[model samples]
Target chain A: MAEPSWSNALEALADNKFVLGDQLVDVGISAPELASALAAVAMAQGELGHARHLYHWSHELQGISKEIRAESGKALSVLRHHENWIELMVSLLAVNVAARVLLERLRQLNEAMVVSKTAKMLVEMAEHITFAGEWCRRFRAETGAIPGLFQAALSRQSDAICAWLRAVDAEIGGGSDMDMANAFVREMEMVCGPVTVRHPA
Target chain B: MSTSVEYRAYAVFARSQRGGPLYQIGFVEAFSDALAKTYANLTYDEENWFELCVVPLDELRWVIEPQGVSAKGESGRGGAIVEQRAGSAG
Candidate 1:
């Protein structure tokens, strides 16, 4: 197999961050509570900051202008799968968890450039994961069950999520979709026990 | 659909560089000490801080008034004295 281009990987990561950040800001405006809205805005800003850094680094390495990179198409299907607030929160948690996994994998590659950038991104992601997990746990505690909407959104977005993982895996030359899915499921279970998906038969 | 999670308030302190004194930068809300630390660092990491720490608001005690005042206290300019209290310690 040919070695994956780091520039391509960075560009893809930057695009994902930009799209996710935009969705987060939208969600922030629609969030029901003040605290959640503030947190969503903060997280959205963090995501945009990550995108800016990643894009700048990629441009430094690949000589691509920020405008061109920002204009490039992004794979945002998974983020767009959430239709409601609950679904949006769950989707953010799932996506961030999956992204963290890929980031860790990239960091483990031992490449100086990749490791440094991934490490910084991971620092911001750590707080994001904490916030998301706490919110999910709070939702589960209050409702006593993972809402059907969240479950449905997760099931609907699973394919896109897997595709994202696969793409990252291909870029990093390691990890599998199955492993990433299993890990994500385990994280979801930890946050909200055994999320049930009611599939239409 | 409520997304407000209860979090304890924590006062954040940071040292700008090595051997510098840790001063109050800002505050963050989190459930645990670990989360508080992470939130403090992530939220206020715009500057190159050498170290950061958080203390729960409940952990610190406050002195209501350092200088006692009378109801109709006189000031040097012959005006009523206005008492002011500091914010929470943490």
Candidate 2:
């Protein structure tokens, strides 16, 4: 990709963080287990923190006090609150994986500040990915021989996830070798199950 | 967590300085080391530690007692040091 101007990409990435953070706490409140709730809250904090940093980096903030950007109109519908625990897990998995794809692309910017911040965020995201994958396996195991519960959820979110990624690729002005949407689907399928991203080659 | 793997207890350790020795701070119960390490950092977030580590409770060799021994008693850990010697004496 011709170096992502990073201006719009940062804005879009920030929006993802805002939506993901909100949905985490919202869905996490109904989490049956205390550990799950706590982990969700922690992840929410991390996402919001990333959103704040991204906004700062892109100079999207109006003033020093107005650091973090609010949720944009463009955030994906799939990122919203879900009805049940499994749905919540799937939503989180999608956002977590897609965001990592974007960040990996962002890492290509290779500037000192961008590289440092993305590196830290990537570290936290590794944990998030681990949590998402573990939850999917756990949820599937709970269904006990009933197949497709995880796949069903992934299928539901796949379209929106692909759209969000396409936007990221476009916003980044990706002329690079890596197709983010395809990369996202590959990583996502590795975590949950097969995902057919119809859009983006 | 109904379908989740059994959660394992992990002993958490951290050091705040560059050369500081890792100190055993506490423990967290988690399904894997990734979660355990995250939980340890999340739970013991008071310090700006330079490093953190989490090891499964089962991995530790029991130099003392292998049985369930409460550390809540007068004994420091395992509650077997003084009591076992007294028991053996009798």
Candidate 3:
């Protein structure tokens, strides 16, 4: 049996995906191209599917029958709506990637179901990340759009993400907050381009 | 004013088994190679293809054209051969 913290974290993560999925479904219509719009809708469906997949795992493994509800009022601040595609892309990376990282930490338990189910979920998650990352980088590359939006989005979400990490990391045996932050930075630099992650001195 | 999306067509191919010839399952139009892939995956998701790929319509060099091959899916008599198939199919 898994710990309560793990179960609760699973529930929370599932809800987070739900929120991101909901937001994406709304913004997906505004995508610049038909292909991106389709991808957005597909990705939204994928997010909702992932949430259900996790909830199923929790129900089966931990017997937590919590509903997969995504009330935006309680969502992570970083996962909120944005006016531009750049910020949307950032939020996608911020939340979706964070969810994957958290799952990685949870998968450390090495439960048979956890490993197999999350492994499948992880593959799809990586593709979503790649899609968001590529577009985010593209937004940065194109001129006549706002500058520093990526940096701003990353900075704005730092505190909430850090707090969330601290709250859940110890229970799941994940690493320090800096480790999570660095992981995000490393991914940003990799997926986008050179990026400066502003954190505490 | 409506935002205009500039894009190019990509021919999507997939194979059902290893060592088999790839079949032209469909085509998708997108602004970039990456986005084209997402479109391809979503559009051609009916099967568990063993392999899949997308090629820019401009990049393919034709040594010869197949009979009944239309450059357009509907407009050209060989419909869907439009280079990304184009024009009226007769």
Candidate 4:
């Protein structure tokens, strides 16, 4: 059988092929294409080799310079996450700390309810407080404030949460029956009032 | 590869000077939520003495730009801020 033609082999393969200069490079089958690709690979390899040598020498020089070493260390911290290093870590930590505060508030609320003997009638209230704190913390950490509860109760998810928080706040405020909720809110306000104001949502 | 990247989101908190409500100041973006918190501290830890909190992106019901709106209504310096997205706006 005759040798397969370049066109036939090229058609059989999935890769694309093109020619450069006087070379009939066949990316899929022709020698010219292979040659060009090989040349490209060689050129890239040479560039990488040069880069590696430069990097080694620069690193050695940096090792000798205390300032450069310190600067590089600082640079590593600064550029770890594409220069958004501080931004990302700090915001999340803020949210986490806030969440902890909220949880502490809930724990106190639960204690208040149990002490007031209102746990049976107001279990949902306690649950709501806990859920809101958790949800707020998670949401803040994940998407920031723009789309979170600050932005109109993201779908029904936010509505449900707001409703729950409002209801709890109301119960804590003592609508009809005199419950421990009132005292709870007052105390929370006393403790978290300064910090809570910072939250936009 | 030079793939284009941009700040997608931010974490911000507000500080209340007097006995007033706290407002959002600025934000920082990162690959994850945890990183955003770290950024929040650096940005707001000084100057205003902010009490920062992690507000979920979705739960943030209100957004007021201090620069865009004048904080000079009946509510005084804290009142003129505009709510960009009062999530619970009925």
On TM-score, the candidate that comes out on top is: 3
* lDDT per model vs. reference: 0.66, 0.73, 0.71, 0.32
For residues B1-90, write the lDDT of model 1, one tens digit per residue. 444546699999889989888899888876667657656765686898888888998887867524345443442331234322222332
Which segments of candidate 1 are over 4 A away from where they belong?
A: A5-10, A32-35, A53-66, A69-71, A81-85, A144-146, A167-177, A187-201, B1-7, B25-39, B42-46, B61-90
The residue-by-residue lDDT of candidate 2 on B1-90, one tens digit each, is 454468898998899899879899998888767667777877788989999899998898877664446544543565565587679999
- Report clashes for each candidate as comma-separated counts: 0, 2, 21, 45
Off by over 4 Å in 4: A1-201, B1-8, B16-19, B48-50, B54-59, B62-90
Query: What lDDT tens digits, residue by residue, belong to model 3 across residues A1-201?
Result: 455657666766777778778778888778876777778788889888987876776566675466645442346766766776666777777677777777776667777866877887888888788788777766666555344666677566655665666567655664665665566556656776765544556
Ten contiguous residues with the weakest lDDT in model 4 chain A: A12-21
Cα error of candidate 2 at position A189, Å: 2.5
DockQ of 3: 0.30
Winner by lDDT: 2
lDDT of 4 by residue, B1-86 (tens): 01232233664776656566777777555433543554454445566553665554545655773443564576355442344335
Structure candidate 2, residue pairs in collision:
A1-A175, A1-A176
True contacts kept of each: 0.13, 0.30, 0.39, 0.00
Q: A1-201 in candidate 2: lDDT tens per residue?
A: 224366666767677778888888888777766777888888889888888777776553333335343676656676665766677778777777877887777667666766776788888878877877777766666655434666677777877777766766665563743378788889987886667555545
Accuracy of chain B in candidate 2 (TM-score)? 0.65
